[model samples]
Target: MFPFYFGYFDPTYIMLIPAILFSLYAQSRISSTFSRYLQVRSYKGITGAEAARIILDRNGLYDVPIEVIRGHLTDHYDPSRKVLRLSEDVYYGNSIASIGVAAHEAGHALQHQSGYAPLSIRNSLVPVVNIGSNLSWVFIILGFFMGFSAFINLGIWLFSGAVIFQLITLPVEYNASSRAIKQLEENYIIDDDEVRGARKVLDAAALTYVAATLMAVSQLLRLLIITRDSRD
Candidate 1:
């Protein structure tokens, strides 16, 4: 199916080149923006952990524990555990990027507190998305080897969970960024200039999610096209 998917068009590699290049460009831009923000010191000089704490407190979510995990950009919110895990850099650094990222995670805590619809939906999808992401490729490969249409269809359905998760995640991420920026401004955690830097960092990070969603959708479309052509 993989080969069949690409074999239908003349110079199929050419069609993929643009998508690959665009994905790369998006990733590069996101990285560059994050790097730039990481260099900019927050005007208030608050550490990332402190910023997260403040945001959570402001949202009446003082119960959410913030912890430093050893990794780079591995920061995330665990809804099930009611914890915000920050990377080593984000937990300790006072850079705009660190604070912005921390604040965004805290926004998730706030979302949980407020019962935000998108965040709720995203949390609901986590289990299925995890299973789907891990098993979809395996099923796809097995289906191809066995020439089993049922297995292939099942793989497609499983993979679709990942695509749905990506789509649902876009709003969750964007809203988190929006909440982060607003909280920063409202609490005076960052000055005007620093807020601008934080905005850049959050915006750049959001693009990464957008890129992932687009890539997933592209692959799903390719699979559908291949499945259709196979029938003919």
Candidate 2:
């Protein structure tokens, strides 16, 4: 009975079903959308790296260097190092998807330069969230095994910090995507017809973050339910 209470068979597992489904759909959607746009070349015929450079320079982020890395959808901006890293496809390819992704990373660089509030807050929470994320499962498992309610509560609190981090990240990512689209359009990097393709790519990418946040919230709710059951 005790094993059943803490195992996958636990009724509380049902809470995660919807989140898991949504996450799968989000992942699939992003992949298909990105792949589709990746085949559609931008009319401007500018490589992704060039697009990023142009956008960065337009915003006076000339000091931020762009580097190319190998992988799919691995592009990101490193605020700590003040560098922009783009995946192979995004850095070298001239597709609408490539340009959109490159500009998105540049937008993150812009966010760092301007000290965007959400990005700043998310950055500040990194260390704490890292610690909490790593230790949370340990405490939760130990508490359940030892029948210690205090430990369970501590684990829940730590996990809550991670949830807050995810919540803050939503705005940061959304703002970056918005900045990317606006810059791409205003500068004529992507024309009106191409804007739809770029938007689809960015919006699909944003859904991934939404899926992540939903998954986290669902897990937190499940933990709370388990704690309540333990008390009962």
Candidate 3:
């Protein structure tokens, strides 16, 4: 069963090598760009927390709180509790990258407050996507090995949720960056020249997500190929 499903463990299935290399390249580029932006201090020298506060205030969302979390680039917005959590570096750093990231999270808060449809759909899919991502691969592998076509199809359906989730995430991220850039310009958080750096940082980061989704799609395609070859 295993041999039939996995093509006798051929070394040539190593196309994954290129995919891995691309993923690493994307991650490194994003990190490097963000680090460079982090070194360029904003003209206002406003810390990330302060930047977030000002953005929220501008949008009339004064009650949403900002907290410093302990991680590198592990910042996110919590819609359930209405909080913007930033990494320690971003929370206190007075850098273009820091302010951009802070405002991005604040943008999520604004989206939540403004009833953004994409964000709302993303929030709704979180639980289903989480469960599907965990179970899909296991079912696909097991079903392929055991020659259970039903299980293979079920796995495909489940994995589709993850793909959809990744696709949906793109707009949420892009819109947040848009909001951040506009806020930065309007509030004078960064000058027109400096805004280009912020855009680069955010754009590089967005590419990582794009890379991830492509990887997932690639894997699913590989699985389909394997399943087709096995049937013969």
Candidate 4:
């Protein structure tokens, strides 16, 4: 009998396997999609930084600063700093993938400007998620060993904040990608073929987020079941 392989059959880890596999697949898909589209130059020849500038300026968001950051797929709009940071590749790329990603960040900027509800809520939950992420498992382990129902419940409650945040994030992410595609089409940033390619990239990127949410849900469920069994 294989000892490590038997871990998969354990109830606690059983629910986790699907999410882990999905996460791996989604990551691979996004990487492949980005790599494929990165080589396909857009007809407009607009760099990602340029695309972000155009989208922001078009929407009267000229004050938002764009900073070039290092790393792959690290592009993000920092609402607190009023800065849109693009990864080295995205910042300099003049391809469909670049424009698509830039436009997606621009959409987030627009959401901040317009006071998008879900984005605001997600931002509010950030601190709680950070603190809870650090302490949730500790409380769970302590409570289980100490036979303290209160501690176990508190741990589950803390982790639930992260799950809720992830659920809200799905809409925020999906909407951003949708807005990016619409802006790309209306503004003629990409031709039909390029748009299709960009969409594919965004779609693949979106799946990664979905995978993350699934992973969190799985963990929360595992904790809940453990706590319930302990109580019984």
Candidate 5:
């Protein structure tokens, strides 16, 4: 039974193949898309930090500070800190890709300001999911070895929180990108042609989140199928 569920040749592994492939594709797509647009400078000539500042101020989030962090593409907004962080490439570069990524982070700040429901929910799940996701497999494995279905069910329930967190993240991310595009357009931060380029970069970024959600759901399904089979 352990071999059936946990061994290298476990059949349940097949369920994750599609999601794994998609995750790889999403990573490559974002890399290539960002690299391609990184070469194309925006007509506005403002740095990514400047672009983010403009958006934040426009939305009356003038108190939120933007910080430059050392990384490749690690731009994000921290609602708790009320800060926006951008990687070196995004914070200093004047390329369309840079501005787009910065705007996306600013969009997240906007979400925080507007009390977006999905963002609120995702944030609330962060602590619980962090703990549950890590220990869920332990419980499942322990239950199987001890012949305790209750432990297995508890593990599944805990793992389900991670899946729910991932699902909620989809809308939160999508809304941020949408807000980014809208802010860029409405503010005339980038030209019309540049908008398309920025949108391509953002759309590619969004795919990574989609791939993650699919992978999480596939994992949950695999666990459910395995548990049912073991019961029979």
Candidate 6:
């Protein structure tokens, strides 16, 4: 039989406040920095999709496709499809923010092309992470109510997959940003001052990932502590 559960929140839930605060800070930082940089357009007036194309072509990744998707900051590189997807604003807007985002996606294409080890590992874990993300909470919640030790343990183990994925992602994302900044500078995509603003955008964006990883770790630890206390 399935277990129905409620009322796990307690003093330990307060531990999550810091992570929540950091998440909010990251969101605000990225938004403000992106907006500020967007106001300072590039000398060349090149759009983000154009920047992405330049990066791809410069890196001999001309075969890689670029597509504009409809959304806010929905840019990403799809390794499975071998395509770079940029948000509508980035695809058409000629701003530092747009170009930084586009180049970052291009950097992912470079990682895929160069066979980056972390990216490869991250790609491999995608399936397990998907499964864990979808089912871990269900297992944890049900196990807690039913006092099923095996189920709780299984759930925690699965949840760890998410933490691991987040950890793996940190280095991958930073490296991509690094590559993007370097490419932007060396290719003369943007002026020196504009490069700094572009880096600010990328750096702020990275903070969100950092906050996410911290939150995941804190949540997992809190759950483990709760389970231990319950067992005792």
lDDT of 2 by residue, 156-203 (tens): 899999999999999999999999999998888879999889889999
The TM-score, computed over Cα atoms with residue i paired to residue i, of candidate 1 is 0.92
Q: Where is the poorest 10-residue window by lDDT in model 5?
A: 1-10
lDDT of 3 by residue, 1-232 (tens): 1323343574335645666677898899889999999999988889999999999998898889899999899999999999899999899999989988898888889889989999999999999999998898788877866889888888888988888888889999999999999998998877899889888988888888888887777666666777677677
Q: Which is better, 1 or 2, measured by TM-score?
A: 2
Which residue pairs show collisions in model 1? Answer: none
Candidate 4 vs candidate 5, TM-score winner: 5
For all the candidates, what are their Cα RMSDs to the real structure? 2.2, 2.0, 2.4, 3.0, 1.8, 2.6
The top-ranked prediction according to lDDT is: 5
Write model 5 residue lDDT over 1-232, tens digit each, in one string. 2336434457887888999999999999999999999999887798899999999999999999999998789898989899999999999999999999999999999999999999999999999999999889889999887889998999999999999999999999999999999999999998999999999999999999999999989988998988898899
Write one digit per residue (lDDT tens) for candidate 4, span 145-217.
6888888788888889889989999999999998888888887777877888889989999999999999999
TM-score per candidate, chains pooled: 0.92, 0.96, 0.92, 0.94, 0.96, 0.96
lDDT of 5 at 191: 93
Clashing pairs in 6: none
Error of 3 at 198 (Å): 0.9
Clash pairs for candidate 2:
none
Regions of candidate 1 where Cα sits further than 4 Å from its true position: 1-16
Candidate 1 lDDT over 117-144, as tens digits, reads 9889888988888988888888877776
- Give the winner by TM-score: 1 or 6: 6
Runs of candidate 5 with Cα error greater than 4 angstroms are: 1-8
Name every residue pair that clashes in candidate 4: none
Compared with the true structure, what per-residue lDDT tens digits does model 6 show for residues 1-232? 1221255346677778899899999999999988887777888999999999999999999899999899999999999999999999899989999999999999999999999999999999999999997799888878887889888898999999999999999999999999999999988988888888889999999999999999999888888877797789
* True lDDT of residue 138, candidate 3: 82
All candidates' lDDT scores? Answer: 0.85, 0.91, 0.86, 0.87, 0.93, 0.91
Error of 5 at 123 (Å): 0.8
